[model samples]
Target: MKRLYQTVPTGCDWAVEAQGLVKTFGDHRAVDGVHLKVRTGTIYAVLGPNGAGKTTTIRMLTTLLRPDDGSARIFGYDVVKESHIVRQLIGVTGQYASVDESLSAIENLVIFSRLLGMGRKEARQRAEELLEEFSLTEAANRPLKNFSGGMRRRLDLAASLIAQPPLIFLDEPTTGLDPRTRNQMWETIRKLVNHGSTVLLTTQYLQEADELADRIAVIDRGKVVAEGTADELKASVGNSSLQLKIQHSYDMERARQIVEQVLKVRSNTSTETGRITAPMTEADRVTDLLIALREAGIHLAELSVQKPTLDEVFLTITGHGVKKDTAVDSSSAVEEVRV
Candidate 1:
């Protein structure tokens, strides 16, 4: 009974690379000329709204789907040409849990271990270890049908790691979990990277990307629109905003005039509340605006500076919010209306 351990060298450099990767379905291009470079042993988050081609990109990289054009390499093996070798070095957790509902938590993991070529004893041992690590030890023998959503997600993640592949692709891994469970999952992901596993995650949650990603790539219209650290993207979209709430609605115009005079730019005035907001690109600009407001005798009931959010960055780049449909195939990316 030989133990099967992945012998591929860990932590060399970029664990996943996509060069001009393109995937099209019918007349629609799901992934168009996308390029990504993810460093080894790091978490790189791909963020966008639904149907942003994130899943398509992940499929091509994992060799689950073939690209119409270009190439994607995982651990230096071509995704299309060397798919078998690539598959051996990577693990994938798609949008839904792929575990067998009839099997107990431990049974599910053991099955994955066996599939990975581990002997029976080794498979059972690995399953038990993972069950404990993911805090599923108490429910080790419970069938997946009896498990909660969070529990099932943890088991799904554990099974992917049964082979301890160097690269892991997580597509919306925390989609349906509660806040506490989502935090727990974040901790688990952090632990994996600390242990030298490189993770490529696709998620619509901006905060998740901000918290976990070493770098984030924003895909819109089957293209990479922005790629940078959270702060970099925020800065690229420009500065924090100084929002002023006037005591009286009539004072809104006054506040706007003062802000515009001080900031030398047109202030964004809210029509509903009469609040005026000016973009503050520099820390000094905040002070300058405050001083100017005081000198102008413009009194603000409330004033606060807010750092640019990822949503703002997305809006700035695409001329619409990430929630909007700006993709090449607009109909495919549109949010489904719930009855």
Candidate 2:
């Protein structure tokens, strides 16, 4: 309930801007030619699989790691040259909890507030407020080592926001949380943005990106492959998806041809279900498609037009699914950068 943020500066339209950012770990180029621009007061997501340089990009942006090449700025201040100012302007919550394992949740938050120069009484009040805000009040006295992963993660974020920096960086904040806890985290993230903090969060979950990001940048193999709003990215793949099942398996090939001819798009078929699938730029065209199928005597058992999902968009652009294993662990690569 207490005021957490200083007045957000009006000097820059972008909260974060980077061009051609690159970082290499010996032989591996963790981040290569990565570019991004995060508008002030919005949730921008860096969507990618593990080892896709999402964390590396975040580290460079947060001033925790230097780029091997390229340039970055936080709120118009050069990340390399004005890192101290940048540090004062942003908060970072890494993949793992960054608090001491032996300290109680309230104690850890109080320490964070005290370190930020809050008065003793103010620090205690602030810690108690954060404990309730993060739903950790019940465990406020429990040592962090006794807390659950979700609880620790919540506290980590609470600690990061002690000063309510203008910009916040969250690297896979919900990686291992249960569905309910993940939803809670999502709400908390939304609240941060609602209260005027620019949030840049890295996420592997397609639903998380779709649910939270005002804009999304899809990264793969250390490069940004796609960038746009959720709808824009989905539109990149297709408008809507058409799935049709022929009443007879013998009509499968005929139906596929009819679909392509009517929809003016290539279509694929599954031999097992005799189903025809194609991308539809115009859902209205389905009326003509159905007429064509009827004229051909291809009775359909089922049909539906579904919006393209982030999963489809990701796969279409990256040429693979979102679960690739990588050798780089950026969370462990650097000491936790709390600010």
Candidate 3:
């Protein structure tokens, strides 16, 4: 694989840029010619399935892994040639908590501050500020080993801020968190961007990207399949779907046949729920479906036309559900490597 990094256009202001990035491990090409542009002070999310090279792209951008071909830049600093400078301007939070279990919440942050070259008094003050900001002030003195998963995650994020980097890379920041805690983390990320910090997030949760990202890129098999705003991507797949809920389970197959034969379009049927979903390409399809169902003596309990979702767009592009693959669970740790 060969990766190339190009500078942003003369007038363009991008916090991150990649062009023709390629990475290979043995015969496996992990990242293939991925071109990305992330503006300053915005959240850019990379979304894909488990083995889709989302993590590999992040590693290349953060300067953790050298691409076999292509180039990447962080704030105009070359990820390969000027990696030290790039590292200085970025912070990263991996999937799992990276805090030292033996260290207290405050101690962990202080350690990072010290490593960043803050004086002892300055480091202590920075630690206190971050602990309070992350709502871990009350647990500052307690060891991280005693904290809940959410608390530990918060502490890990807070530690990443010790250096006050302008760019942050968050890899599955909310994975394994409860709904409430996940929302809280989302709020934190929003707050960071509000203060002019840029964030690049990679997540499996479509809802997370929909809520937090200013732009999204969907990658698969080491290549980018689609890139746009949520609504834009949804629109790419074309037309809404009319889902019909038949009165009886036995009527589902019959309804599907009618929809396919009459509408001249493929109909998707759910065996468990007795629902038939067909793409609504024409305005009269809904009316036609209802009339055909009635003529066939099939009672439809419910009917709805729904626009495509981000999940649907992902599925259409990848030929698979956006759900994570369980076989890659053990390799997720390897995916966390970042600058």
Candidate 4:
């Protein structure tokens, strides 16, 4: 609840702040001392595998669930003590669409706007604009029951932005959408920030976090295993990634061993492609590696060095791949105190 910044930069304003937040459901400590600082008007992503407490952390910060320990402030307003004020400052869109099944798209948006205290005419106008912006004007009159998953997702986003609150919490906005539709959602999310709305989203898609977030926190088993920019997290894994394509398929294992010995790091070999990949702390080590490979009669067809990807960073930090599953914070058991 208090504005405290021991680790965050001094000059920036945080849209959401929480420190040592904890939550438990019987035996499982769902959220274990999670901490986050989202800068105003930036996209901050929480990336984690399933059941990693990403949703629990979001619920605590958004005042949907009470934390057993620590505290959080939304725009300097306490989520626990100043929940009413905090609610006014934010919007939340969960994974599932929260709209009336019998209502049309326009009707749903208008209803949401009106519920937020907008006049009927103003609500209708706002609904139309949102429908147009989300490219759902053609289906504005279609019933929600007939809408596709992507359409419903977009409408859900539009409903959440009816008031255009300062901060928005999106729990995997692009889940279950087609590639094209997912890209559209990404653009909309970017536009939200461009128009001065801060976004805090949780996603298991490593590429989504890498593409959308200004900063990312990787949570695993209810703990923040890593936090930083995509580049920073990647650098934490390795300074650069070295990739080698062997001239002979049978030589891949030998090449991998040579690479591991020369680079002094573990290397992965692809039997099919005759490729060897390893992390590199020094780029200059490539010369020695090439010499060693040549002496060992291992010829390289191609070679390259690049930064580590978010997938690699996830594997390195969490020791597992990302799992695509709905985050269960058990919010259904707790009566939602909607604002």
Q: What TM-score would each prediction reach against the true structure?
A: 0.82, 0.79, 0.80, 0.78
- lDDT of candidate 3 over 233-276, digit per residue (tens): 54444357677888988777788889877766555677888777
lDDT string, candidate 4, 1-339, tens digits: 222112222344988878788999999999988777787889999988778899899888888999999899888889999998787778899878988999999999988888777888888999999999999999999999999999999999988888878889999888899999999999999998998788999998778988999988888778777777766665555756788999988888788878878877766677888777777778889999999998999888999987675456655565432221211111111111111
TM-score of model 1 (CA atoms): 0.82
Q: Give lDDT per model, in order.
A: 0.79, 0.83, 0.77, 0.80
Winning candidate number (lDDT): 2
How badly does each model clash, as a count of residue pairs?
0, 0, 8, 0
Ten contiguous residues with the weakest lDDT in model 2: 326-335
The best candidate in terms of TM-score = 1
Across residues 91-183, which tens digit of lDDT does each residue of candidate 1 receive? 899888989999899888888899888888889999999999999999999777889999989989998898888899999999989999999
Clashing pairs in 3: 2-69, 2-70, 3-69, 3-70, 3-71, 4-70, 4-71, 5-71
Instruction: Report each candidate's C-alpha RMSD, comma-separated, in the order given.
Output: 7.1, 7.8, 8.3, 8.9
List the candidate 4 regions with Cα displacement exceeding 4 Å.
1-12, 239-257, 267-277, 280-311, 318-339
The better-scoring model by lDDT among 1 and 3 is 1
* Model 4 quality (TM-score): 0.78
lDDT of 2: 0.83
